[model samples]
Target: MTETVEPFTWHVAQDAIDDLHRRIDATRWPERETVDDWSQGVPLDALRDFVDHWRNHYDWRSTEAWINAQGLSTTTIDGVDIRFLHVRSAHENARPLLLTHGWPGSILEFRAAIPRLVDPEAHGGTAADAFHVVIPSLPGYGLSGKPTRHGWKVEKIAQAWGVLMARLGYAKWYAQGGDWGAAVTTQIGRQNVAGCAGIHLNMPIARPLPEDLAAPGPDELKALAALQHYQEWDAGYSKQQQTRPQTIGYSLVDSPVGLAGWIYEKMWAWTDNQGRAEDALSRDSMCDNLMLYWLTAAGASSARLYWESFASFAPAEITMPVGASVFPKEILPAPRKWAERHYTKLVHWGVLDKGGHFAAWEQPEVFVNELRKTFAAMD
Candidate 1:
């Protein structure tokens, strides 16, 4: 691990932006989907419209500016250069909080919630709820350096996080995440790493063990049915990413439309949108996330994490204080009873009325309040 942490800034070259537009303009699109709905994937009409806006009206520089407005830094940990945004609250005794983003998402997901978290008083809360926020671009995603070797699974990532917080001189900290982040945070809790105060997850991955399944109740059965539904209808992306990331990587890295459609489908399918994904998330926000994957060429490398650990990324029993905010439309909303089985010391649990897999992005105010309420008792 290198002790030096360097300040970082994002500046996409003009030529690169021009090239991206040219590619979008010249894309060889496929025929429209057979169905009227999003069953076959991102509808050709929707993707074409999105690409047109991306080519003509979307402003990448504004997104870049937004990211640069936050405090950015990079450090080498476990042989990879990790980029992160570290924002400290003005309030003394502010708690240290580390946030992790999942696949098909980036640190951009938390952009709206950062100010509220770091300076709660300014966002209609007390200094007592302030947090020193740190949001890292996951390895092989966004501005973070892609791993050259093959061993960058969730466990290694969790360990690297421990090292990261320590390097920042934090003696104790809370961790929070959704999706892959949830997996990493869960691992951190299970490891009981020194200085890790507790963990909170928006997507709690607590499944019924074989025994629990033998005589399950309605909630457990509902959770199981949801999991089954995911495996059946919603897991094709995971299957491909886990089995043939490089195959899909070729298209994702080579074609911006391919990358956009790939991610756009998830935004549509996974969000709490009634019919269209844009109902819950704006085109700019969706495009911002797509740009992270496109600019970094992280399509394959990021997907490789699934190949590396999907089967093995099962939830472990954790005794550390745990908090969960269950979004109703999450990929799989584990029942509180099921979560209690895995999170033995579950200190907080909130069943959100709305929101989905991308809770922070979909409902920033709600997400922030959940974090504040979840961790308040910890203090």
Candidate 2:
């Protein structure tokens, strides 16, 4: 018999928000180090302003209301109860598309893009292009129940997603993700699910080539140069999370400001629009994403995914048609040649005009446009 899953429950207790405020107020702050770039850390002044607003003015209830307004649903799959926002168009024959989020992120990442995907009419698109959207909080992230076991690696999570899609009765569907979501999509492609037609990803992992390895053409060499830069300068979080998640968890769990700073710095640095996190992302939006981690106590569990998959880097020689929209500011961009070695059915690849690691959150319009164009060609 097929497994039965329930709809999402949207509610956040007042005491939890209050507790967050209490912690922010009682935080035992550390001495600040001046004269350091963002590399040193989130600036003290920026962190303080965010905390003051979080405690004094930010509205958790309104965030909850906006979430409810989206009309999301929750479900249980493969013994892990999952929370997701499922949206479908009025057209009965719309295609199914599963959207997954990555670490330091929640389903909240797609808040702006969901409506456009679901009811394209509202966003100047036709019903023919609508998708039955399934945006799930990865296991141990957001409202999804924390994993009780140790083996929730990428492959295992992909299996769970398969069960989720089948439970929803989607015979054929597409998958898209960024960050770890990109990693998960690679696993889903590897699963070779009979009904998975094609996969779309903003983030694609390439196998590391030796520096002495014979170089490809100029384009490929440029891509390799970009990858090398990322490894050196942009990978500290990976090192910490993969080795000592618990140590970092202590500070993040105790202080909301600490968590915000931890996440905000990365967002500020990695986004497509450099040095414009405030203009690109509002303080409210940033706090809302952080609140998901804070309320769920998912700091360590989310980090552990890094530890488990740190070395399990599979450069998938993907047999299914794969499309990648590469953003310049993306932490790592696999060269088209290197990517070709892994994806046998690579059909679409574009160095996007703009955006960075968090494509949807940072450059939603560019991201949405790319999706429409690529999927249209395949359709």
Candidate 3:
């Protein structure tokens, strides 16, 4: 089936920008948290400072220009329009690579890594390290069209990715992802889709079996403890998004501050920062990510993904060649043995001393190096 591919240019209406500012300016103040730290959530003082910066200084047009500079295109696949960035490398033997992003993230997450991956020679890498990259906006997340019906789960998204790679004339390709993206890429491996050479994940989701737990090693025990800590402390957003996304969607769409606070807290909790999210991500970068959600009015639509496929994306075995980079600050850091249970042909495993959930966004150089090394081994 031939699909119509159209060039995409991003432009936010002036009125929408004005309205966002008005909302930010008119935001009602909530009482300060009872505690001094961020245990309750984003601290009132920190949020206020961030909101002031966002409203007063953030530049959306510059961000739009940055996006426009990429090879942006959209195509209708399986009755849904998908948006993606297709950047081909100048290197003759460049491998096609599909990169995916997860919740609270968009195609922008991979912006910095794109050029380095696509034109490695220009970035101190050999031509052999080059990759023709395809970074897609997950359905209903960024510029991609939202689903009007049900059944748009990760499995379906994985199938769509296969179709996407095929549509782009990639008969054989590699894949990489983190967060919800890890789930999608893992499904692609599990399904053993044609043309999928292998996969690399920054966040590999693997659970210890009952028997494995019986005789856990030090790393496995630490992993299990981290998983438990995450479920107890950091999973409220997941539950809300999975069960009642629509309820919070109203607030997210109507209030820019509300959306920022929702995502900003995760930045603090998930990133390798020193008590502040800004320490890891610049104010402009955070605003750029927030604008993808704010401009698209994707608050409810994006959250619906959790409702559609969170539980279904639990850890499962994948037989194909696999690589993983376990960042120290990830919500749940799976040990090598634990991941090996699922990734039978685990080829490359790197335990980095730094970085977090948003690997590419937080540490692009380290992230790029990991991908290069991981794929070189598998290649």
Candidate 4:
């Protein structure tokens, strides 16, 4: 049977938007955090200001228009309908590249990175640097269909991505991702199936060995410190989602304010923002991401991915060619030696000075350049 792909357009019901406003207006206020800084989480004032802008000023229609412009399409793979932005390059030599986003993010995370990757000539690069970008909404995230059954782990998603690329006639392709996206992409390389040429990750997963623990270097020590900080201060959401997604599902699914607050804390913590998440990402863009969650009621479905795979996040040895760009502000920065231990065929390793977990969203130019270089090394 021939593959079917219909163009998708975005138009949220007006009633839903009105209801969102009513919910925001009726939000039961929480007491302000005692700390002036973000030590206790997104400060009350910051969240109130963000919620106010979203309720009163953010243009959901404009965001919908932008999504429609990105060449949206939908097709069912396995048992799920995946929504994606497929931007083919004008250049004939463009390589196929699949980009994925993690929790608290949708395909909108790559809004800035897409045009640059697909049309590098206009941006900065030559035809050889162009990519036919395939950015799919992960199962249970964004506009993709939520899995009705269990077992949609990262590895399963990796296999489904192979099917997606093959369905689109991409026998050979490159994969890139951050956060959970990285985990899935790593699994792609681990499976090494259906002509995956290479994989690139902004947040590569690699654990330290006993020897390294006994005698840590500067980079490894710093990475460990960041890991400690994340476990101690930034991992409450992870713990909750990995253990009981259904428990928090009630609040996240029912209350838009709850969903927004949950994601806003991540944006504040993960981005390379100097003081505030809005400093690095535009309020409009942030609201656009938030709306992806709200419109789809994806808060619980997205979190379920954690429950599926968080326990199996152990490092696996991969023989396929791999490259990684380690942003300085990554939640857990990987030392070159650690990456080399797993990605034995590690070809490109870039320790960037700026950017963070949301590499493409936070720094598009650098992110695109890193893609061009990393995949080129894979070539």
Q: Estimate each model's TM-score.
A: 0.97, 0.93, 0.98, 0.98
RMSD of 1: 1.3
Candidate 4 lDDT over residue span 1-379, tens digit each: 2257779887788999999999888889889989889888888899999999999888989778888888788888777898898889998679999998988888988999988998998999988899999999999998899999999999999998998888788989999989999989989988996779999989888999899999999999999999999999999999999999989988998998899889999998998888999878999999999998888888889999999999667677888888889898899788988888898888888889898889999999999999999898877
After superposition, candidate 1 runs with Cα above 4 Å error: 210-215
Give the Cα-based TM-score of candidate 4 against the true structure.
0.98
State each candidate's clash count: 0, 5, 0, 0
lDDT of 1 by residue, 1-379 (tens): 6778878998998988888888987889898789998777788998888888777878988989878878899999978999999999887589999999999999999989999998897888998889999999999988999898898888889999999999999999999999999989988998997799889999988777787789888777778888998998899999999999999999999999999889988998889998988999999888899999998889998999898879756878888899999887888778887788788788889888899999999999899999998899787
lDDT of 4: 0.89
Q: What is the C-alpha lDDT of each candidate?
A: 0.89, 0.78, 0.90, 0.89
Candidate 3 clashing pairs, residues 3+ apart or interchain: none
The candidate, 2 or 4, that scores higher on lDDT is 4
Q: Which ten residues in a row have the lowest lDDT in candidate 3?
A: 1-10
Q: Write the per-residue lDDT of candidate 2 for residues 120-140, one digit (tens) a residue.
A: 778878877777888888988
